[model samples]
Structures are given as C-alpha cells and as structure tokens.
Target: MVLPTRQNVEKVLEHFNRKDGVIVVKGKELRERDDTDVEVDFRQESSFYYLTGVAEPGFYVVIDVATKRIQLFAPPVNPDDVVWMGYPDSLETLQTKYDVDEALYTTDLDARLKEASAVYTIPHFNLTFKDEAIKSASTEDNDALYAAISEARIVKADWEIEVMRKANKISSDAHVKVMEAAKTGINEAELYAIFLNESNRNGAFFQSYMPIFGAGMNAATLHYNKNNATIENATDMILVDAGCEYNYYASDITRTFPVGGKFTEEAATIYSIVLDMQKACFAELKAGAKWEDIHTVALEVAAEGLIKTGIIVGEKQELLDKDVVAAFFPHGIGHMIGIDVHDVPKYCTSVERIDRPSYRYLRMRRTLAAGNVVTVEPGIYFCEFMIDPVVKAEETKKYINVDILNKYKSVGGVRIEDNLVVTEDGYVNLTTAPKEIAEIEALMAEASSKKRKLE
Candidate 1:
C-alpha cells in the first residue's frame, strides 16, 4: 500500500511539478451530527487517502514541486487526548509509517506555505485549511490538478484492484445470506439486518451506501431504503441493492429474487429480460469500447426483449429512437466503482456524455480502459410514476401494450447488478452471487430444507 501510495503521488507530480507551487490537500476531521453529542465515525477523504493512505483526521499533505518532496503535517497529541483516545503515534512513527520525507506539527503549516510562491489544492469536495496569516498568499487554480488526479484514478492500481475484489466477495456472500433468509412472511427490514450482519461478520467496516431492500411495489422505486414492508405476496420479488466497503474500497451489487424461492410467471419474464440485457452489455465491455455505445446496445436489447414479451410493439431501432425504452429502463446502464462508487474521470479527452435520454444519466461516459472497474446493472421497472404519464400522453401511448403492462403493474422491477473490471481482452466479473434463476431457486430450496429439519 505504501509503495502504491508513493506511485500515486508520483503520478500527481507528473502533471504539476512546477518550480514554485506547492500542492496542498486536507484530510477530513471528526464530525458530529448537528448540535448533537453523537459523532460520526471518521473516514479520510478519498483524495487524501489516495495520496497518503493516512486515515487520521487533522492531517494534511504538502507536495513541493521544486524538490519533489512530500511532507505530512499532523496535529500534536496532548496528554488529555491520550487519556480519552488511547496512545497516539509519535511524529517519527507517523513519518516512517506513511513514508513521507518529513512529518511536522500542523501548527507549522502557515510558516511552511510562506516558502512556496503558490499553494494549489484539489477541486470541489476538498477540505481547505484557512489561516489568516496566509490570506495574502497567491492561490493557484486547481483545475489542472483535479483533472490530472481524476484521470490517474480512472484506472485503478494493482493494490486497489485487490481490495475491491475482497470487498466484492464480502458483498457477494452477504447477498447470498439475504437470499437464503428471504421468505414470504419476512419483513424487508429483517432481510436488511441479515445483510448487515453478514457483511460485518465478513470484515466490512461499513456499507458503501444505504441498503435497498425493496419488496413488491417498493422495488419499482429506485434507491428505495425505507425497508419496512412485510412481504405478504409469496409471488412478489425482493430487490436488494446493497454492498459493503472494505478498507475504503467499495463493492456494489444488486440481486432480485423471489420471496417464495420460485419466481412467479410475471416476475420471471421481467427477470429474464433484464438478465439478458446485462449479458449483452457484459459482452461489449473491453478496452477502448465506447461506453455510450454499450448503453445503446443495452437499450436495443431491452427494447427487443420488451417487444418479444408483448409489452411494447414497434421496431427496436424505432422504439429506441423514440425513447420508448426509457419507460421500462429509465436509468443508465451502470457506473464506475472505486474509492467512490461513482469514480472520477467520467468524461475524458476522447469521450463525453451524450444528451440522449438513456445516455444522460450514464455516470461514466468515457471509453473503457483496462483496470477500469464498473457495474453492469440493467433493470426493467414497472413504476407508475415513470410509465403512467408517458402512457397517458397522446404522442407516446401508441407503442405501449397497455393491457399487458397493466398485468405487470404489481410486478415491481428486476435489476441484475454486478461489478466488473475491464481487462485487455475482456472484463472480469467481481460479483459471485447466484444470478441464474435455477441457481437462486436451488440455493433457497436448500436453505428451506435445512430450516424444516431444524424445526
């Protein structure tokens, strides 16, 4: 990790090694809920962690471009602090631990900045330290630095890939646990708890995001997190979009499974379409592949599936051109995943987001490159909010099979999400949860047999 952090810093220096400027980045401080005694756990900012791999707060890094020296500034620990927060590492220990050229007390930061002609920081979402003494100092714009770092982070380092693989494994196993625990009578909250407990037991520090354990109609609402519904219909499906963070690297996966261990006819039909769409997208993932084109492929495949299933009637291309696919599959195909779930360098020199309906929400619009990890999640939802207005509109209602669509009004949605890393030849899927319909049914049936014996 130390070597990788050093390499990452060197990458940053490649673009900003000027004679007079110093690059400054601030780590996150411990934060508390507004006016409350409860304190949120401290996690170092992503950029700070990328450069220094230091997790503690009240720390900052200064990279001098002239000498190419890296200095780490940390807050001095007091005796009173030690009493409450345990023993603190000495300056020499931290210096050696982080492999920095020099480690000094943060109080000396102002004096150090005076030696440099300009101070530069990363763009938005950065912690900027303010000192009245440095008000007169010239501040360098950080656009170039931000773009450089973001580009560098687009393709992950070897160490990052390793951490992400582990995170995905933990998340994958957790999803399996939830699938086994799911049943017609279980509340969504109970399934959520099962996922959390499994992830924690498998060594996840925290969830990358709030778990989405939507049952029945709730599943149609993307990003649903209320998770309080009781799954009364044995035939309804459960969509669990959840993942955990391991060592600050994130893994995102979503699995939709039937509550009764076997998918109902309506649920199975939608699931097959979504699963096929995911496979089509996966086949197109490789180095230099255009992301927007991949999304277009997803739309074409989904539209074709909808047409085959009698939900929509039209030529595939015409349906896509008319934006009819957006009714069933509203969101983009997927997004990049790394320290941040939606990783940076979304648009680069060769690629930018397209303004079309499906491509607009696409998080990563750049061409694919080896070492880039992304999620291939394509869904087919039956949400009334997204479909009703379009169906009622006189212009777009002709393509919709209203009778067939009404039959699935209660079907909710089906999303098959998996994390994958782009390679020279193709992509390697990181998610290992059971996705095949037969596989899911068999796993749940085995769990039920064990439960019956226990009872």
Candidate 2:
C-alpha cells in the first residue's frame, strides 16, 4: 500500500472521530486539468493525498462515522485498458491494497455517499460534484466535516516525515551533482538540465517548482528561472535553487558554486559569511524556537559581516536597525516543507493566514515543532541594481561602500540551503550535498578535466 498503511490513515481517522457523528467524505478528482495541446504535469491535490494516499486520479474516499469504516470510489477498469495504459487494479485488489472496507466503481459513489447523513468537502468550486454536494448538504453538520478534515492536515505524521526524508535525500544529491558539473563557460541551462536529469534518475518525477538557474548578478532576482545566461570564464558563480518530489513529498534546496572550479577571493569571502549565518540558524532550531528569532539572527550576522568587509560603511547596528541588510540578503530564511514545498500551514494562524517573518516574508511563518520539516537558506549577493538605490540613498549614504561591493557584484553571490526536520531538542539536516567551497571546486575541477580529456 503506497498510502500510509501503518498508522497515517489511522491517525487521521482518530482526529476525525473527535467530533461525534461526524463523517468525512473526500471527493475525488473533481479538478483534474484536462490534457491539452500544451504539456502539463497532473499532480494530485495534496490534501486528498495526505488522507487517502491514493495516487490515482478521479477517486474519492468516504470515512463513515457510524460504522467506523473507510471506502474508496473509483472507476472500473475495462479489459481493453490493459492494451493501452497497462492494467489497473481490480475492485478486489484496490480494497486490499488500500486496506479499506470496500472499493466500488464510480457509478456507485452517490449511493454510497447517500448513506451518510452529512458530506464533508472543500467549498463549492468548479469541479465534478461541487454543485451536487452543495445541493445535497441540508444541514450545518456537513460544513463542519469539511472544516475538520481540512484542518487536520496541518500537523504531519511520522510516515509523512519518512516520505519527506527520502525525497530530501534524493533532491539534495541532485544539487551535489550540479555543483560538480558546473563550469565557467557552460550555459546556465546546461547545469539546470544536469540537476533535472539526476533528480529524475533518483525517483523524483515531479519538480516542486521551476528550477532557478541564475548566474552572477542574475541570482539577485528572488525568482530567476531563466537559465540562459552564459557563465563568465572567471570569478563568477552559479546559483541553483531547485527541489524534487517523491510521491507528493518535496525537498527544496539551493546551492551556489564558483564556475571556474575555484572560489575567487571575493567569492570565498561572501560565501563564508552566508555559510556562517546558515550555521547559526541551524543551531537555533528546536521544538519551540520561533522561526522569526532565527531569521533575525541570520540577518544580523550577515549585516555584521557585510559591514566588516567594507561592503557597507555604516555601524552594524545602524544598518540592522534600518533594515538595510535586505539589499544584499532578502527573502525568507526558510519555509515549511512536506507534500507541497510550502505545506498547508493555515491552521497555525489565528485566522488561517500565512504569517511571514521579518526580512523573510516570501515563505510562511511558524514556530519550530517536532514534526515540522523546513528549509534554512541564507544568502548574500551584490546585485548592483538592487543595491544601487541603497548606495544612492541620502539618508544612509555613508553606509554605502559602493566601490567594495562593486568588486563582488559580478562575482555573483553565495547561498547555502538545506532541508531540515525539527527534532525534540534541535533538528536534523536532511540535505546530503557538500556545502564547502573547496569541496565544490574539487568536484567541478575533476568533472571538467574528465570532459576535456574525453573531448
């Protein structure tokens, strides 16, 4: 059973049973985007997958409160199906694999759901049974079921953690391969393709998001996915921000490396600073530590290093107080990772909003918890366009060491990101890639020399 057969489904059922007489009915692929002329990957909804672990599309699950039983509704497979898309599970096989009480053809879904006094589902949307479910729900009881199950997924299970661990390891290895393959003259896309190939070879059929393969100052852009830039021959670096997914579990990681097989003086300096900040963040991770606390510390450390390096002329406290450090190191320090890179964390907030930490607002905010898996990425880049205004600003003009920062502007930036799982006392780094600059240079040099010899 690909789904959580051990304890995951049982854990969810236990939560659902809290409300007496509440029956949870999860509707199937009411929202599969039709395959069109344009190519698109169809991923199942994360919420649905969490409960049922059913990868097949166009199916629904009903958890009956009265009987304490689970049922799956799927379309019957025809004998001709084996000639085309391979054999699908028979009704008997489906029931056994899912460990459900029964598996019925989709034709019998209505009759099955009709047995329940209430139906729990996501709010009305343009899907197969949206109108029908809404029309049928005559009491407030059904609405409560939807809310209860939706909120139940906020916390992760041990099995879900295991899946994410496997995903993180596979994706992290892909990052290591990309570092070794990068060269100064290679097109940024070339490195991206290598990571993609490696990730797919390791069982990641889904990319959590489009790979960001930016080089030099292009790395300054928070979401640079255009990997078309030609890597400069000297003193430049490549930034690969990518992730892979196994089943639906995702791992997000970013690694930057010197393209010429060695970190230049400037590159090494910037790289060390960011790495130190990341280490500091990792050290503070624990069951109850507020993510914001870690984020604030990362910025302070980066700001202090930037100031000492003469990249910024102002006092460290002054730059920090005014939030000037964001010019070089912006974006969130981390985010929750699970079935989705940014897992459904709405339940953590007072009104179910995605709260963000200061200077790290792109990712959602929450305190560290035992089962939470997240990313810790801290970076520093001298993106000229980004820092130009800060250098030109009259209020903080003295703090702008534009000349020193310019030397490293073309040197690109350094970012070290890893997937981390919060533990009882601290956290475990799930990423398996090498983060040392020397290690990156060694691998790249070895790979490059081999390519040259072959050519």
Instruction: Please tell me which predicted candidate would have the highest lDDT against the true structure.
Output: 1
In model 2, which runs have C-alpha deviations exceeding 4 angstroms? Answer: 13-39, 65-68, 78-83, 124-155, 351-362, 452-455
Regions of candidate 1 where Cα sits further than 4 Å from its true position = 1-3, 15-20, 125-140, 346-353
> RMSD of model 1, in Å?
2.1
- Report the lDDT tens digits of candidate 1 across residue range 276-395: 999998999999998878888889889988998898988888888878889888888988889888777655655666787667788767778999999999999999988887788887
Q: Estimate, for each residue in 212-310, the C-alpha lDDT of model 2 and write its tens digit.
A: 998888877778888899986756778888988988888888888877778888888888999999999988998989877898889989988888788
lDDT of each: 0.85, 0.73
Q: List the residue pairs that clash in candidate 1.
A: none
